[model samples]
Target: MNTKKQTGIHTGLPKLLLIALSLLTFTVIMTACANTKSAFPDSEGKIKITATIGMITDVVKQVGGDHVSVVGLMKAGVDPHLYKASQGDISKLDHADIIFYNGLHLEGKMVEILEQMAKKKPVAAVSANIDHSLLRAGDEKMGTEYDPHIWFDVRNWMKATEAIRDVLIEHDPDHAEDYKNNAEAYLKQLEQLHQEITEKIASIPESSRVLVTAHDAFGYFGDAYGIKVMGLQGISTASEAGTKDVTSLRDFLVESKVKAVFIESSVPRKAIDAVIQGAKEKGHELKIGGELFSDAMGEDGTTEGTYIGMVRHNVDTIVHALK
Candidate 1:
């Protein structure tokens, strides 16, 4: 008997565990639904929206406005690529009227739980609103179909705002006008933000407009703003940077005379430091420009916590460091 094939391929222990947990949550969710009355806050007249990441959480807040209550599964500095849903999360999902996520497997492990919840509730991927042709295809490093960091591009992120507005309207037709007005206000702000970024990026000498980070989350940002982007790791931070990747990128920085590379608020600085040290050893001095919000945003209530403010901070940091 070909038990090898029958046993199924083992991707990794982490993946197996994620799958097992996903199944266990299924039963837990069912039991919780049978016993629990209200899984989320104040039983009220608002749409219960649960979002997977801070960026999407911001969209829900902006579009849903006064008519929706939102619960974000992932917090600031939380890496969604490695995030797993807990039992409490399952209860929240079970009670949510609608759920939003970045999709394209950005919430890599929580995907099954989100999809399972979709059988009963509305689960939408705001990233799906972006034009498919505009997406950056993932390479062997990411092992995915397309890159999931659409929030890096302000224009692409606007699509997320629109998607959220539409979803909210569909679910609550009573507030359709409110959702449209709020989204329109946000979109105008985003339009201005995109223009601001384009002009800011253009200010740097064309040769000097390079953005290096811990991972390849800035592909859309670079393509949209016309700057060069490189990362020590791949599209997913789950993949670690190798010795060869460090040395080659170090050589490129040295040869290109790139000024600075930025670390991420969510990612560790070790790999970026290694690349910097490698460049120094090879006769180049590269400074840590500043921390950029890549996968996550800044703390709540801070300017950088909001999407527009986050983009502004990133562009300002980049322009200051590179220029």
Candidate 2:
């Protein structure tokens, strides 16, 4: 009887040990999974981010600091309105951990592609947080539901910075403090930029504050800075200005006694040139003020390539030419 009892006890001990080992293995796996779920990219492991335009890319870089590696799809002088994603761009988007775009139909041709990619990964519009009341309406010709050029207004861009900061925090809680600090710094810079622009624009006498350009990209800018903006084409560069449009703008320039009109870096100079010719034909000589960073920033690695630099250059040009 004693021997039988000993054998039973020994067999039961092995079964209990087996059960304990299985439970231990299960707990280890679940803990590893939880860690993986919570982990975010850090300096050791950088996040891969893709931005649609240079403006968005610049902001992301400033906010993300060193924890992120960003790839900007559209380069300087590239028109986002008509830009379509190439195969390489599509591949980049697919591999990115996150994506940022201007939205509001700004990237008109890439809208569908972005929508599809959003299903598999986190895709954000930098302008998502901007108040709708602050936005301008788009004309029917542009096929835009709203004017997509929100970055022209410094205030609007500030809202976008907040949005980007919030997204980075949500994704990388480990670096939340870092992102917050960086965002605060960038916001302060933007505030300073706004003040500088205001003073410069104020230097221009109110009557001569008329800004004419290739397209309706500067409506928000004019509204923010108290300048009256006129563009030959509609909101989107996809829309072309006809002879009638040029003639009408020319008449307005002559009647308003505007000293200078401007050409855009991304837009063809032909429309503006035509307007100039039309004004000359009517005996009103209007010079092209200077090339403005519209739809895109200046060349990469230049001061105008940055968001703050682009805004400053634009204000300086406008004030110098129109003042």
Candidate number achieving the greatest lDDT relative to the actual structure: 2
Instruction: Candidate 1: give its CA RMSD in angstroms.
Output: 12.2
Q: On residues 170-208, what C-alpha lDDT tens digit does candidate 1 reach at each position?
A: 888988999999999999989999999899899999989
Q: After superposition, how far is residue 267 of candidate 2 from its true place, in Å?
A: 0.3
Q: 180-274, model 2: which lDDT tens digit per residue?
A: 99999999999999999999999999999999999999999999989999999899999889989988999999998898999999999999999
CA lDDT, every prediction?
0.88, 0.90
**Residue 87 in model 2: lDDT:** 79
Model 1 pairs whose backbones collide: none
TM-score, prediction 1: 0.87
Query: Which has the greatest TM-score?
Result: 1
The TM-scores, one per candidate, come to 0.87, 0.86
Give the Å error, residue 114, model 2.
0.6
What's the CA RMSD of model 2 in angstroms? 9.5
